[model samples]
Target: MNSHPLFSLVAGLLSTLLMVSCAGSKSYPPLATVPEVNVQRYAGHWYEQFRLPNSFQKDGASAEAQYTLLPDQSLRVVNTETRADGRQKTATGRATAVSGSSNARLRVKFEGLASLAPAAEEGNYWILQLAPDYSAALVGTPDRNYLWLLSRQANLPDSTRQKYADEARRLGFNTTRLLYRPR
Candidate 1:
């Protein structure tokens, strides 16, 4: 039995593991001039144009997320989706804007159901980009794991979509990970 072959196999395995680990690591570019996003102007109904798939939301379906300012400096998030079976599902969560910096950063927790334990780390949700007219928004997490393209109405114009995609790319988000939901 030659020891050289065994050593080469071990080296290859280690290199593969290292590469995989590095590829899986998460990093996000610094916020690009945190915009002065008015929470009041942002509050209302937004339709999901694209999103990273979550177990809660199904594919090829229309969904709406309603945001309302709560009394305690937090947001009331109500997400409703029309499923393929023609049934509707809704999830409610609370989002608290991180203090300072014009409320561009927020923490969202969906552990409202009594049966589930609260999340250990409040999910970092950031509004990366927003149309000056408040017609569209690009949102993502600090770790760059979750990103969503949302519009004020059920459909967004092609120009708006392209603009958001370019902005997301500029912000170093993985545009390939963006999953467009059917209108």
Candidate 2:
């Protein structure tokens, strides 16, 4: 019988790859959000202090988000960013508060082709941490793949940034993965 060594090697590699993938996928406890969110008080302009790397927001020097309360109680989300080339990019979206979540969870849908990605469609926009004064916030997805630190002020204090990093770490996020624009 003629045995092909290449076939066995390929099968072994595939097995190893599958095992590694399965072992690397770690499932955590259900992501928790603050008890409640006052969408009315949350409405206003916010500066993106830090975020996990994502494809759509690449090349941004600075980013800001504005929220307007709609008549239907949904939120009008307008995100504007200054790219490294000095041009500005803006996107508009709608955020409908998830029912019975005390206005905490929101299903956000950004308009345009960017919405086509199934990976981005899973809307958790979970508010993991919110400042009592609403001055700073830590937002992340349940899957732990996305995270953002925001502040109402353009320049957030160093202490708050540290708090964000600590909280994110405690929440099963790798703080080292967070990206921030230099102020």
Candidate 3:
């Protein structure tokens, strides 16, 4: 079957990402998240400073996430990104904090084909590092495959960027693979 070039590229990247994550799992020690996260302070707009490459976010720039605390305590997540085609894509999702995790872990589900599968309901969002004033955060998965460095602003200073990279490296993620978006 002859698939479109873009589709093939996306499929290949997705496959490679999953295979690498599984193959690299044994090399890292158990992933550890912060002891607690005050969702109240953590809520609001967060700019994506950098992230480990993933198929779902290909050709996207200026990615950002907005987390709103719902009355029911579940969070309404809105993610916006400018695409390579000069279009903006915004996805809204729901996130529920894992019980007994002190809000450090979240199960995020967006409205898409993936949500139809039961396995996609599992928790994937882990808060690894958060600044005292909630100015910055390092979030990743337990497998150390997916990682994102988030900030309250789009441009992080050189020193702060290094600090975030150092933290991700220390947490077992391969910092060299980080992909930064357009400023």
Best by lDDT: 3
Clashing pairs in 1: none
- Tens digits of per-residue lDDT for model 3 on 1-183? 685888667767876887776884547777788899988888899999899998778745669899999987888999988777778888888889888888988988888875642222236899999999899999998777799989998888878988989988987899898887676
Would you list the C-alpha lDDT of every candidate in the order shown? 0.74, 0.82, 0.83
Q: Kindly list the per-residue Cα lDDT of model 1 for residues 64-183, writing each as its tens digit.
A: 899998878688988898877789988888887776657788877774462242221323678888878988888886555578888988878777787888888777777876667665
In model 3, the Cα lDDT at residue 138 comes to: 92
Residue-wise C-alpha lDDT for candidate 2, range 1-74, written one tens digit per residue: 56478856775786587567656776567789999998888899999999988787874568999999999988
Ordered list by lDDT, greatest first: 3, 2, 1
Error of 1 at 139 (Å): 0.4
State TM-scores per candidate. Answer: 0.76, 0.82, 0.82
